[model samples]
Target: MPSPSLPPELLLLVVEAVLPPNPYQLLPASHISTRTLLALTRVSRATHAQATRLLRQRCAFVDSSRRLADLLLCMPRLVPGLPPVLSLRHLTALYIAPFGASLDDLPTAVWVRELFCEVCETLRRLVVQMPFGSLDPLDDHLSVRRTLRDGFEQLHRLEEFVCVGEYPALSVPDGHTDVWRLWPELKRLVLFGVPMDSHWLWWDIATLPRLEHVVLARPVRLDAVNIKDEYFHKLPREDVRLSRDIKVVLMDLVYDLGVVRTERWKEIDPEEKMTVEVFEVPLPFYGDETPLELVTEWARRGALDGSVWKLDATKVRQEEGSDG
Candidate 1:
C-alpha cells in the first residue's frame, strides 16, 4: 500500500499548529519563508484567517527617540487592509520610553485598555520620568495634569495607575480630582519622586474603597510655612477598625546628611492622650547600598508597634540593585 500525499492546505494547517505563538520565534521555522507563507495564506480560508490573527496579535513597535511617530503615522497607509492591533477590548498592556512621541499622535478611535505611557498620558499607566527643573511653572504643569485627566476619563475599566514624576504641587485642581473620582475600581497605585507635601492627596485616596496597596518614593519636603495638619488628621488611624484597609509603603531618601525624625501617632481619649507606639527609621541616600534594608527595618519596627505591615525583603533588595 502507498502512503497518502499531504495536501498543501493540510501541510499549512500542521505548520501553523506546531509554530510558536510568538511570531518572532516562529519566523525561523522551515515553512515560514515569504513564498511558503503566501502559499499557506492562499491554500485555505481557515489558514488565512488564523495567519492574519496571529500576525496582528504578536505585533510590537518600539521607537526610542519619538522618531517612530512618522512610521506609526504611515501604518494605516502602508497596511490599509490590516486592522489596528490596539482595539479597545484586546489591548492589555502598553509601555513607552521617556523620549517617545506623545499619544495625541495616535487616532482617537484607537483604544488601549492598559497602557504604560512613560512620557505623558493620552494613555494608561502613565509613567513620566521626573523632569529636572523648578516647579514654579504652573501653566506647564497644569497642561500635563489636564492631559492625564483627559486620558483617565476615557478608560472606563482602568484598574491600576502609576505615576513616576514629581508632582508640581499639593493642591491638585478640581479637574484632576474629578478624574481620580472616575477610577473607583483602581486597586494598586505607585507614585515615585513625588513631592512630600502632596500627602494631602492621601485624604482623597482614602475614599477609594478598592485600593489595596499604596507605594510612595522620594517624597519632597515642604517648608514649615506650608505644613498643614488638616490632611494629616484625615489620615487613616492605626486602630484596626479605623485604619485604612490598604497597606501604605513609604521610602524616604535623604539627599542631605541631616538627621531623620519619625512620627508617633497617639489616640486621645476623654481622660488622657497616650502614645501607642513610636515608629522610627533612618532615611538612607537614594542610591545607598542599604536603602532596602533601611525600609525593611522601618517596616519591621512598624509591625512591632502593632501596625499591620509586612515587607518583601527579597524584592526590595533585588529592586535596589536594578536599573528600573
Candidate 2:
C-alpha cells in the first residue's frame, strides 16, 4: 500500500510549524518543491509579509571580489526582496557587508532606519562589515550620524553589536556616548580594526547599564597612560550599578601579549567590579598561546558572573595576514 497524499493545507501547516527562522536553513526546504516553498508566502498575510523577516534573520554578506557590483550580485535571492517583505515587528538579527561604497548610493539614514526598525525591534545581535571607503569624512558625516541616530533610536532590545572595518573617513563625535545613552539593553560589544584612541573613545562605557563584555582588536595607537588617567580621574569612584557589569579586552596588532597585558587598566576604572583583560600578539603572526590564554582568562572571570568572553585569535591572524 502507498502512503496517502496529504492536503496542501496540512503540508503547509507542517512546513510552517517546522521551518527554522534562519534563512540559510530555509533554502533546503526549497528543494522539496518551489510550489511548496512559495506556499510559505500564502499561509497568512502575516507570513507572506514576513518572508523577508525570515530571510534577514540569518543573512551573511561577503565581498571577496572587492567590487560593489560583484558583492551585490553575490547576495542570495532570499535577500532580494528583503527591503519589501520585511516587517518591523519580528526582525531579530542582521549581518551586512557593503563593498566599493555601494551603500553610499542609498540614503544612509532612511535605509538604516528602515532596516533597523525591521530588525532591532526584537533584535538581539547585529554584525556589520563594510569597507572603509564606503564612508566619506566630510560628505557623509551628517548622513552617518543620522543613520546611527535613527538606527539606534528604538533599539532598546539589542544585546550585542559586532562591527569590523578599516579606518573609515567618517567620524562619530561622542558616538559611543550616544549609543550607551540610548541602547539600555546592550550587553556585549566587539570592535575590530578601528583607528581611534580606544581609551578615549570608550570613556563613557561606564554608563552602560548592562554591558558586560567588550573586545577591541587591532587598535591602531591607543595610549595606556591617557586611558589609565582618564578612567582613574574622570570616571565615577563608586557606582554599584555601573561597576558590576563591565569587562574589557584589548588586542594590539603590533605588540606582545605579555607587554600589552601589563597596561594600567586598574587605574582607569578602580571599581573592584570592573575587570580589564589585555592580550597583544605579535603582528602578522598568531600562536595558540594568545587565544588559549585569553579564552582561559575570560572563562575564568566570566564564569564567576555567569557570562562569557570570546576571542578568535586565529581569525584575527588570518585577517591581518591577508594582503588587502
Candidate 3:
C-alpha cells in the first residue's frame, strides 16, 4: 500500500522552510511565489487556513500614493481583522516608501493611522521611507508625527523601527525627538535624510538595553561618524552610563550625478564582533530609473574603517564620582 499523505500543517512548514526570505522584503531572491501559495491553499481546508494565516503575516509594498490608497482599500479583503476592531493581528513587519515624490497627505491619511494602530502590538519591524522633499504643511507633519508617536508608544516589544524621508516628523524646534519615549524595547534605529547634529539622542538610545546597532545620516552638512558604545557620550557635566552593545553607521546626503548603482554598498569595518554596512548608495524609494540625488551620501573621503570618533563613558563615570 502507498504511504499516507502528510498533514497540511507539516507540508506548509516545509514550504516555509524552502522559501524563507521575508515576504515584507518582496526581494527577487524570495522564493515565496504566488503560484505556490495558491497551490498550498487549494490542498485542503487545513492548508488553506494555515497558508492564509502566513500570507497575511507580512506586508510589503511600493510606496506610491496610489498604491498605498489601493492597499488600504484591499487589506480588509485579504487579512482577517483583529477582534473587537478592524486590524491585522498577525502582521509583524512593513516596508513602504513613496517612490520619487513625497505624498505628504498619505502619511496623514486615516487608513495609515489605523493601520499603524492595528499593528502596534505585533509589529516588530517597520520601514517607511518618505525620505525628504515632503510637500505637506508643517501642521500636517506635526500631526503625522504625533500619530506615529501614538501608535509607536503602544508597541511594547517593537525591535526595529525606521522612519526616513524629508523632514522626519520626529524633528521639532527644541531638538528633542517625539518618538524616543515610544521605543523602550527597540534594538535598531535608523534616521536618514535629515539633520542629526541637533538631536543627539545619545541618552535615549543608550538607555535601550537591547539596542545593538544605530545608523544616523544627516543631510545638511553630509557628516558621518561611527562609534562603539563601550564608551558612550560622556559630556563633561552629565551622568553618563554604559551600554556596550552600540555599533554606529553614519553618512551624509548628497546629490551626485556621478554616483550610480542601487547595488553600490560598503561594509567599512569588521571587528571580531562588530560590522556596519555604510551604503555607498542609499536605496532609492523611487523606481530605479529616477535620477535623484536624494540619498544620504557617504559624503566624507575616507576608508570608513570604524575609526571615526570615540567617547569614554567609563572615564566619565569615574570623573563624575570624583567631582563630589
User: What lDDT is reached at residue 274 by model 3?
Assistant: 34
* Alpha-carbon runs more than 4 Å astray in model 1: 1-89, 98-145, 168-182, 197-199, 222-244, 252-324
- Give candidate 2 misplaced runs (Cα > 4 Å): 2-56, 60-89, 107-109, 132-134, 141-149, 152-154, 167-181, 193-200, 226-229, 252-272, 278-309, 312-324
Q: Evaluate model 2: give its TM-score.
A: 0.56
- With candidate 2 superimposed using the best TM-score fit, by how many Å does residue 227's alpha carbon deviate from the native? 5.0
Candidate 3: list runs displaced more than 4 Å: 1-10, 17-35, 60-87, 98-100, 106-108, 131-133, 136-149, 164-167, 171-176, 218-231, 234-241, 251-279, 282-324
Measured by TM-score, the strongest candidate is 3
Candidate 1, lDDT over the whole model = 0.38
Give the Cα-based TM-score of candidate 3 against the true structure: 0.61
lDDT: worst 10-residue window of model 1:
269-278
Q: In order, what lDDT does every prediction score?
A: 0.38, 0.48, 0.47
Per-residue lDDT value at 318 in model 2: 14
- How would you order the candidates by TM-score, starting with the best? 3, 2, 1
Clashes of each: 1, 2, 11
lDDT per residue for candidate 1 within 1-324, as digits (tens), equals 899977757765674664444333212123344335545545555465555444323222222423234324433432234433333224222222323233231222122211222212222232222231333326443345344345446655555554433332322355535354466667656554445455446555556666666555444452311211322355454533224344445445344212222222211222212111112345644655565346444432332222322333112111222221
C-alpha TM-scores of all predictions: 0.45, 0.56, 0.61
The sequence of per-residue lDDT tens digits that candidate 2 reaches over residues 198-308 is 554555465666778776655544543233344444456665554464566666543333223224444444444555555544333545555434433343333222232
Report the C-alpha displacement of residue 177, candidate 1, in angstroms: 2.9
- Model 3 residue-pair collision total: 11
Ranking, lDDT, top scorer first: 2, 3, 1
lDDT for position 145 in model 3: 45
lDDT of 1 at 149: 42
